[model samples]
Target: MIQMAKQYGRQSPTTPFLMVRCSAPATWCFFSGTNNYVWESFNNPTDTILPTQVMGLGGMLFSRLTQNNYSRGRFELHFSNEDVKLYLVSRPDDHYYRFEMFNATNASESASYQLVFNESAYINIVKRNGETVPLPLISWRQSTFAPNSNNYYRATLDFDGVFRQYAYPRMRSLIDGDDQSWSVVRYLPDNICNAFPDQYGGSGACGFNSYCRAKGGTPSCECPPGYTLMDPNNKFGGCKLEFPQGCGVLDDELKDPMESYDLANISGLNWPYGNYEVL
Candidate 1:
């Protein structure tokens, strides 16, 4: 990660500005001072943010390529169309999944300027002069995570593009005297499917042809029969249909048109984007 930061076209970039690689998730860029710290936005933020920081105009948060890969992914968070929104980057010129701010319709001048996470844990859209504006519906939850006033906190865009808040509690240690420990306190959107629905070729949390189901408060993917996983190693990549595309040309007697397909019906499944179609 340090090597990648060095290659970012800056000469002799050192501490106070560092690229930290976590053992579990993706890499992160951090900027720290004597009493405060922040995630330095180099125009490319991968899957996270600190509560003390601000997401200003043109600043974007992107998810990782996969759960295991640290590179950039297809999800994005940015200010656009007179509001702050979350989108899925489909094509270079195409973006989907727009979750826009509800209360900033009259304040376009201040709405897209900067998003601030005040010390009170309120995520607000504000102007250059620090005038607070309304935020998106997803960020309206009350944050009751009251820790020590000196402790640090972070709001990260997770691997699946879930916006979450984490707290680092300050405590006195026997050897270190003063320290902080990390813990998650909040996550937004509530459902992964609401953020990543099947819009463009099953473009949700579980990819195409797969459904997102919550099991024990965690999202899991499942593909219908007659289809198999596209990448066995990456289960979230979705599945591929096993049947032939065009008409079968084989001359064998068992090659009947009806015999080549398998029939299975899903009962309780809710179709993506909306409900079932009318007959």
Candidate 2:
């Protein structure tokens, strides 16, 4: 792809943008610029986050991923369950990037960015912070160019998952160049986890639990208390009893006998049985 870009004079300032389509699910794509800007797209969204873009909040930036096949990568960046926390996940690698927004309070906010494809591609996020600080910056350089106009670029992912670049062109309007220029588009493919429900533990959900599979979909049943994933084959198979022998056993030390006994305990306990084991 790099060779092609060079052939078209994409390396020069005359070309403002470049667009690349995916193998399938054409909803998402890659955009790049002569100035070293890059971004991914999902048709459009109520809010969007672009690649190699900075979103300031205590000197941080939010970065987007390139399309694996004409769609957003399965990996996602989200806030942690803890107060003002954040995390990045891709399949088994959950919380790949984690951090706290603030140590002082629980205040939260949400917004989106956009993907612009011209001579270059870039994802832009809205500025949420009003106070200015001397934030660190990074630069992404084109590694190679092909005759077909395909090019490769690289950027760094900060500890907070914010991206910074020093050489990329500033955000511009599809019609006019403006710092605040942006537009909301429909989301391509529409759903990010099209094939992996268990991984997401249901849409808009996060975290690792006995009922959530690191690979896909939500577990149908709850894991036995005090126990977590027991079978590696089926992550969402539900948790198993920590100690099978302890099932139905009551701790006599408890002051209340009835309260101390669990589902495993009862004088004439009738075990409800089924193919409860998920492989």
Candidate 3:
């Protein structure tokens, strides 16, 4: 980002701005004396957003490549119209989830809208008048979390493509042995497998050759027999065949294809995406 103290490029504004701030995820920003922000990070978002921040219309939240990797991933949440749509980037305009707003807006009126996940964990698309255009996300459930303590909260588009709100206890508070891990307050597209019934998208909730199953509001991906995870450290990264079987193989192996490649049964399994004929 270029910062010209006196001017921006060849053009100059009526009043020369004094400061610049970048409120970003992973990357941080700071400010002291209050003068309106000529630019702010809230307007521009990353994979996660704090509860108080708002994402304007046409804003998007992109998924990360993995839990530890910050590279851009394949999932996207687009706020463009009456619905907050989640799309698979590789599959183009086909959105897996369509969360409808509480109230519809008139096409003729000019209005500005912003999306926010309030302190209580309610995702709303609100108008300037404080009217909530509810995206019909799950209702806010009361939690025992104490912000005054070391509790922290954030809603993130996870690596596995599930958008979730998590509350973590930064420092231990309880005397008894308790699970102080980040707890999921809410998540959407409840059933990841059902979201990708048709095998067409590049990869559904999980990666290719892996299937998605909701395990406590999170998508748990697993590889089947004869296949192993591509990256064991990152299970959601998908899997690949353990043994290569093709024309490149020896003639003996090709001749006894049935003996070399035996059928393996996986009950109650749903493949993310594949040809219907193969099912």
- Maximum-TM-score candidate: 3
How much lDDT does each candidate structure score?
A: 0.60, 0.32, 0.68
Candidate that would win on lDDT: 3
List model 3 lDDT by residue over 1-279, tens digit each. Answer: 333345546655344344453544333343333444455566667798886677776789999888888899878988865667787888766877777653446643214677886665556788766778655534322333234335567888877777777788767766876578988766777766667646465667778888777875567888878889998887877789998757535755445556556777778875443356555
The superposed Cα distance between candidate 3 and the true structure at residue 248, in angstroms, equals 11
Q: Which stretches in model 3 have alpha-carbon errors above 4 Å? A: 1-39, 102-111, 119-121, 137-152, 169-181, 247-249, 252-256, 271-279
Q: Alpha-carbon error at 121 in model 1, in Å? A: 3.7
Candidate 2: tens digits of C-alpha lDDT, residues 1-279: 332335455564344455676443333454545535365453332123333334333322233333122233223333222221123443434433233223323345433221122223332223235332221111112222111223322222322132322133234446754454222211111122232333333222221333322121111323446666655443322355565443334564425545545653324211223245333
Write model 1 residue lDDT over 1-279, tens digit each, in one string. Answer: 223235457765554544554332333446453323455343344576655556766667877767788777766777653555666566433333344443344555544567666666656777655666745554533345454565666776656656667777555567866555766666555665544434444356677777677532245778898788898866667789877664655654446668666668877667754545321
- Which is better, 1 or 2, measured by lDDT? 1
lDDT accuracy of residue 273 in candidate 2: 34
Runs off by more than 4 Å, candidate 2: 1-68, 79-94, 99-101, 104-129, 133-279
Model 1 CA deviation exceeding 4 Å by range: 1-44, 91-112, 134-151, 171-183, 195-202, 215-218, 242-251, 272-279
Instruction: Supply candidate 3's per-residue lDDT for 55.
Output: 78
Clash totals in order: 2, 42, 0
Looking at model 3, which ten-residue stretch has the lowest summed lDDT? 139-148
TM-score of each: 0.64, 0.22, 0.72
